[model samples]
Target: MKHVLLALDESDDRAVAQAETVRDLFDTEHTTAHLLHDFTDNFEGASVGQIAAVRHAANILEDAGIAVEYHETSGSPSTSIIEAADELDVDAITIAGRERSKAGKVLFGSVSQEVILGTDRPVLVCSRRTEE
Candidate 1:
């Protein structure tokens, strides 16, 4: 079975939309979806490495009959995702990308961009286009 790591930020609505897209694209019967969240800081009531944004995405995959797993870790978001993918030996890493201005990207390096640059594994970026 193909193993896919879905890199998600639980607080982002775009991640929810990306989850739906991932569910539709992969074959549930033949694929395993791993939901991953990189927590950079401690939040109240959260154990270290516990994901706050998994249920909605997990529900979508589970309802489709796809095997699902969750992985949460604390670190640089891109680095954490790369480490998880390497450790899991996932076939691909999927992430939701949002448009950022050149200035924004220069100031704040993008996690998706870092993951793509740091790893040789195929990265699938699901982008949400914003209406102007």
Candidate 2:
């Protein structure tokens, strides 16, 4: 079975778009998606499944016949994502990319960019656009 690590933030649109990318690009019946959410701070013992965006993405993936697993952690998002991918040995990683200026990226540090550079596995970056 194909394994994909879907790293999600708190944005429903972005999470749904990432889920759609996996549904459209892989064989849903034979693929497994591990949904990972990193709470950067103030998690207060919350779980990944409790997040709205994560729940939305999970529903979409499940509806498409994809097997789903939930993972939650507290730390650096990009570091957590890369470590999860390595630990899960996922075939690919799917992440949402937001528009950021060079200065913004340089200052804020793009999680997607760091993840893309950190891992050797294939990465599918979904655009922020949700509309057709």
Quality of model 1 by C-alpha lDDT: 0.78
- Collision pairs in model 2: none
Residue-wise C-alpha lDDT for candidate 1, range 40-124, written one tens digit per residue: 8766657423554577777778888888887878889999999999999999998876656977644323777799899999988
Error of 2 at 76 (Å): 0.9
Tell me the tens digit of each residue's lDDT in model 2 across 1-132: 999999998999889889999999999999999999999885377788889999999999999999999998789999999999999999999988775787765533378789988999999988655358
Clashes of each: 0, 0
Measured by C-alpha RMSD in angstroms, how accurate is candidate 1?
A: 3.2
lDDT of 2 at 128: 56
- Where is model 2 more than 4 Å wrong at Cα? 101-109, 128-132
Residue 88 miss distance in model 2 (angstroms): 0.4
With candidate 1 superimposed using the best TM-score fit, by how many Å does residue 129's alpha carbon deviate from the native?
Answer: 7.2
